[model samples]
Target chain A: MNNSQDLPLKNDIAARFLPLIIGLMVYVGTLCFVFTLFILSATHLWENQLRTQITLEVPASPGASSAPLQAQVLQVLSKTPGIQQASAVPKKEVETLLQSLLGTTLPVDLQFLPVLIEVSLNGREPIDIPMLEARLKIISPQIQLIDHRPWQVQVSSLINASVVLASTLTFLVLLTALVTTTFATRTSLLIHRQVVEVLHLIGATNEYIAKQFQVHALKQGLIASAIGAAFAFLTFIGIAALLEKAGLPSTSLSSFSIQAFCVFALSPFVTGGFMMLSARLTVMRGLRP
Target chain B: MSDFIAQFVGVGHQYKKGAEIFKGATFNIEPGSFHFLTGPSGSGKSSLLKMLYLGLKPTWGSIRLFGEDPLTMKPSLLPLLRQQVGVVFQEFKLLDHLKVIDNVSLPLRVRGIEAKRSYRDARELLNWVGLGDSLQAYPATLSGGQQQRVAIARAVITRPQLLLADEPTGNVDDDMAIKLLHLFEELNKMGTAIVIATHNQRLLERSPYPHLTIRRGTIIRTPKRSKP
Candidate 1:
């Protein structure tokens, strides 16, 4: 005798399974959205770190003291308009970097070690890398200027691809949820066709009948979406904890901005609206003469 | 409002891939008048009642209820028109999930009446139908006669301008049938038109109302016989 629901939708098989399926879909969708956000933030951080830095390599020359070549390159870099600071990388530090890669230590006086200079730019104006390279080449044909632009481009492409993939996955998850709701609503209509006809005979409007289904859908949808979002949040926490334990950075991946939290909070209501709309449309169509 | 609660003109109906059930059947039901709709099995008794309540539209013809042609009326207005008519289906058509009281109060709830008032009225009607104790019982748990009483309570709860009953006395005993007849008479006395479709010759013989008998896909009106 619950006046709120005229139909026995609570006993429905669809009612039992709809929340679970919708919850699973919402979980995947939330993860996809978070991952896209992570990738975007990580890309922005990497860009800021790489944009103002360049590397210059002064190759070793046999029977030539590279000190003069290194000093000459440093002088040329200082004369450049946009260059802020340039310093030669110590040989021991370079040796340690190579040792980490090759897993072997070199002799202290290995004369074949190239002279490396770390260059920092002010980033206020664009630097013509080819012009800078030509200036450095005048000092020695072996000098090479390497800016981070190419690496940044590759990283940006990878990030863009990840974002596209995540977006597509989120879209697919929502579409599946929508289709599930539609089928469930249609099945309910079929199962309760006799009850619906009785309601009609008793002077009930189609809107009246449809409202019952809509209310059922909204209730189920809201509960399922909340459960899904909560589970997704737990997953985010777990992943972040795992990443932290593994000695990796998890801030961008695990931390939610205000906008992200808002999106997550709004997901349930949005999903509920879609489900209610689907139920309403299905009822209207099923009841149509 | 129109003097006639419902009017049918040259109405005909058929199912898909089936022969016409009834054709060129025309009749007018005046306010507060009672009529017995009698017909042989499969004689379209149910179909005629369906058209009366706007449950089924005739394949061809014009029908008016509350002075509005249901066929030409706005679809949105159909429920408002239907609100003035009530039907007791032959199959009982009770929602198995709903309790007896809920089923009886359904018509009022559909009209957006407050539950407190609707349930109070439904409870009083159920008591009159001898279902006061079974108010909390589900339809599946009720006997056929009890369910029929529940349907009757639902149809009359609104005090609709017209009441259409199909085989209303089919599942009841002679005493309960007479009681139901008296109940209909009381509603008719209150200016609510009534139509009871039945095959019970005894009830027909006992009643003083005219009969609209469906004969060979046509309706034939028979005036009430004078008491001996």
Candidate 2:
């Protein structure tokens, strides 16, 4: 039967409120996704570029010709196998690096900090850090290797926390959407109890009654998801622009994987399906008694 | 199927934590027969009709509709059986939000009939009931008698095998009540079994149909007059 014309009870005031609520929730969820994507992409870039690099620091000898010692160290590093290249960092460049961190006002005692040398590995063979340190002691006893592994571990932990937080927020968003749909559907059932009775009296099946709510919820979900997804997309673009202005790595939206952005298109359908499922379950439970 | 449209043997109904509403009642209604149930307020007439229409199950004793015991009927089969029966309540029970035509077409729609065809039939029935101009008007806009007619139109739209009406003439004046009676008579002549529960004595005296009078949840039967 064409029961669509039977009545307009499905689209009540409460039903109208669902889309906006769901939209707000979806907005929150999509924002979480964007944050996680940004963190992962930046971490991946850092890993790729820094994994094969090492640094050596040389203490300035109090009374020796620092030039001769620097020259000798550079010569020994060049002779080591698996070392693709070695160069003494310019003092002025090291000061520039310090300016970025410690600012331009460097204390006179801090000027004796150390001379830094950057070392690159060919990546084809593994070099033991202890053996390399022992060999480097022959050129100068003050040479210390600074492998980036510990720093990488710290960065990995930070990325892991971001991902966990994003996943938790997305889960909460889904739960909120499900709870809201259930509340709306149940309220509608209570509000229109008389209508339900009349329909039941006329031999309408429980499935038919439940379908009324399902269609209404699906429509609302689609609308809310559209608004939420669109807002999320715009927010991501804005964040990308801000990050680019601030010189953060991987600031472009396309810099992330396609799966990262695909969420924007799929959000509405997922929420719509969630809404339909919630309505069906709620209506059936309401009608079963 | 049993030859009788409805049969009740020592049927009883009792509400939870409440006194008994049915006190061991027994009765039968033959197919294509028309009978009137006369009773005062709270005489259990509506409750008995409810049992016959599967709105409630008998607390004790055997009860059958269309020759099958409704007690053992599966829930999945309820809609199919309910579609074969029609009921008009004392309150008219019309959905206030639905228009007159949509309200009248509800039974057919529940039976899986297409709205296009049901609306056409609903329109014709509304015209027949002198509510043709009110087709597009909601049930809340109609008078008490008009709502009652819409309920009748809905009940009989599918041409159910049996029709049970509780206090069909309760809200209307004597003239309107008589007009509604003529409508029921026409449906009854078409081989539908009809059982009307009412408090109007004028109707009982004017018609030759047998009367089943209920008092204190007990029934007293009076045979129909032989045609001259």
Per-residue C-alpha lDDT of model 1 across residues B1-228, encoded as one tens digit per residue: 677889988899989988798879999999999999999999999999999988888999888898998888888789998899988989988888988889999999999999999999999999999999998999999899999999999999999999999999999999999999999999999999999999999999988899999999899999877753
What TM-score fits each model?
A: 0.85, 0.82
Q: How many steric clashes between backbone atoms does each model show? A: 0, 0
- RMSD score of candidate 2 (Å): 4.6
For model 1, the local distance difference test gives 0.88
Any residue pairs clashing in model 2, and if so which? none
What's chain A's TM-score in each predicted model? 0.80, 0.77
Among the numbered candidates, top TM-score falls to: 1
**Candidate 2 ranges beyond 4 A from true positions:** A1-17, A51-144, A249-251, A257-261, B1-3, B16-19, B66-76, B172-179, B189-191
Q: In model 1, how large is the Cα lDDT of residue B162?
A: 96
Please tell me the interface RMSD, in Å, for model 1. 1.7
